[model samples]
Target: MVAAAILASAPATAALSADGGVAQPARPFQFTVIGHPFRATSDENLLRRSITEANQDKPAFIVATGIKAQTEACSDRLYAQRRDILDGSPRPLVLLPAGSDWAGCRNSAGRSNAIERLNRVREVFYPDNQSLGVRRITLTRLSANVKFRSYAENAYWEQGGVLFATLNIPDNNNHYLPEAGRNSEYEDRLVANRAWLHRLFLMAQRRNMEGLVLFTDGDIKAHVDEGFSLLSGFSAKQDGYAAVRKQVRAFAEKYQGKVLLVDSQGEPKATPAITWRGNLGRLGVGGEWETVRVQPGTASLFSLKDADSP
Candidate 1:
C-alpha cells in the first residue's frame, strides 16, 4: 500500500459531547520517539534493533524523529520501510526531522554539497509542497489531528490532548557559514529560521497545550554546566543560537513545570528542584528529562536516574 493510501482509511466522525462540545475526551496516551536513525550505515543493525526495542511496549503513538527521507542512498529506503512497519502496527506513527535527517548537512562523506543534498531531501520528504507527497504507506488519516507528510523541519501538531512542536536546529552536519566567508545570506537565513522557531512556540502557547512536548535531535547541554556557558562554543550562529537559547529558557521559565525535553543519548543538567535523569535506555531512547519542580496538579512522575547509576 502507498503512504497516502494507508492514511486515507480512517473515516471522519461527527458528534456532540457534554456541554455541546465537538471534541471528545482523550484517552491515556503514550508513545516512543526515536532520534537520528541516520540510515544506520556503519552501526550494523542499530536502526532495526533500537526501533524494535523502543516499540516493545506497543504504546499508543510511536514518533520517529529525524528520519531522513532525502537520499535514495541511505534513509530514503529506510524511511519508506519504517512507514510500512508502523502502518502494520496497532498504533499511530508520526515522523519529525532533526539535523541530519532533514538533509541540512553534508553527507556522511564530507565532499557532498549542502544545497544539493538538501534539495534531494526536500524532494523526497516534502515533495508536492507538503500536500500530496507524504511517504505514508496504507495508513488512515485521523480527522481531529493527523499529518499527511513529514512536516518541514519545524513542524507542529497535537495528539491526544498533547501539543507537540518540533523546531529545526541542524548542525548543517558541520556545514556552517562557509568557514571563512561567513556569508551574510547564510546568517540571514539562520536568523529567519530562529524567528520561525519562536513563532512555532507562540503557536504552541496559543493552542494552550496542557502537555507541551518539544523534540529535538541535537546535543542539549551535552554535558553538565551550571551557567550560560551551557550555551558556549556556539560562535558561528552565536547570535542565532543564542536567540534559540533565550526562547528555550523562556519556555522553561514560563511553563517551568509542564515542559519536557526528549533527548535520546543526553544526560540532563541539574537545576534547583527541576532535574530528573531518564531511564529510557531502560526502555529505549533513554526516555526523557522531566523538570524537577513540584507544582500543583502535576504528577511527581520520576523515571529518570541521576549521574550515579550504581
Candidate 2:
C-alpha cells in the first residue's frame, strides 16, 4: 500500500457525541524534523528563520537529525554551537548526531576524537532526562542502565497515541569498525542499539500505540529512487544497519499500523519528504510504511484533520 492507500484506510471522523456536544478524540498534531544543518556564516540567517518559523508553527515537538560544520571539521565548539541552535527553539527539541558530526570526523584537522565529540553532544544536547526547548517532554533513554550507558542520545517519547524514537544510526554503515582489534566499541554500540530498538517495539505494543516513528541520521530503507542496491551503504550485509532494518520491518509488519521510517541525510528516494508512502515493499510488512525526507529549511507538515471534514 502506498500513502494513498494508507489514507484510504483511515476511518472517517466520527459525528457529534451521544448528546449534542462535539465528540473529540485528541486533535491531530504535527512535529518537525530538521535534517542536517551544516552551519556557516551564510546559513546563519536561514537557520534562525527556520527555527522562528517552527516556533510559530508550534509543532508538538521538533527534532534535528544532526548539525554539520561547513568547512571546519567536527569539534566540541561546533557541537556546542549546534546545541545553542537547538536550545534556541521555543518548542521541545530532540537532536540526533549525524556522521559528519562525529564518525566522519575521526581524522579531522581539529584532532577530533569521535568518542569525545559524541560525549559532548550528549552532554550539551542531552543534559537532562527531559528534552530541550521551552516546552519539554521526558524521554525514556537507553543509557539509564547498561555498560554503554553514556549513550543517552537514543531516546523515545509518545505523543498522540504514537511512539516516536531516535536512534544514533548515522551514515558510514553505523560506524562498523571493520578493523580486527577496533571492532569492540562498534560491537558494543550495536548490541545496545538493538536492545533499545527491541524495547521500543515492546513498549509501543504495551501502550497500544496507533503508530510508530523511527528516525535516524542514515537512510535505512532497502530501496532508493534508482532501485535497491548495496552502494547506499545500507545493504543487508552491513552489521548494524541491516539488523535494525530487519527488526523494524518485522515489528512494522506485526503492528499492522502506520510505521514511518525517517532518515535525515540521503539522496531522497521519492521526494524530499514522504519518500515512498506505501507498504514495506519487499519485506511484506503489514503497516503503512512512509519514509520522510527532512533536511534544513524543508519541513514536512501534516494535519490530523480529514480533507473533507465539516
Residues 247-278, model 1: lDDT tens digits: 56555455422455554433323221223232
| Backbone clashes, each candidate | 16, 3
Off by over 4 Å in 1: 1-25, 37-44, 66-90, 101-112, 128-151, 171-175, 178-189, 222-226, 230-240, 267-310
lDDT of each prediction vs. the true structure? 0.42, 0.61
**Candidate maximizing TM-score:** 2
Find the candidate with the highest lDDT and give its number.
2
Model 2 gets an lDDT of 0.61
Per-model RMSD to reference: 10.1, 7.5
Tens digit of lDDT per residue, candidate 2, span 85-195?
Answer: 778788898877777677756653555377776776778777778988777889988888766588898999987556788888876678776557765657777788878
Clashing pairs in 2: 1-278, 2-278, 3-277
Candidate 2 is scored at a TM of: 0.75
Candidate 2 residue spans exceeding 4 A from truth? 1-24, 39-42, 107-112, 222-229, 232-240, 266-270, 273-310
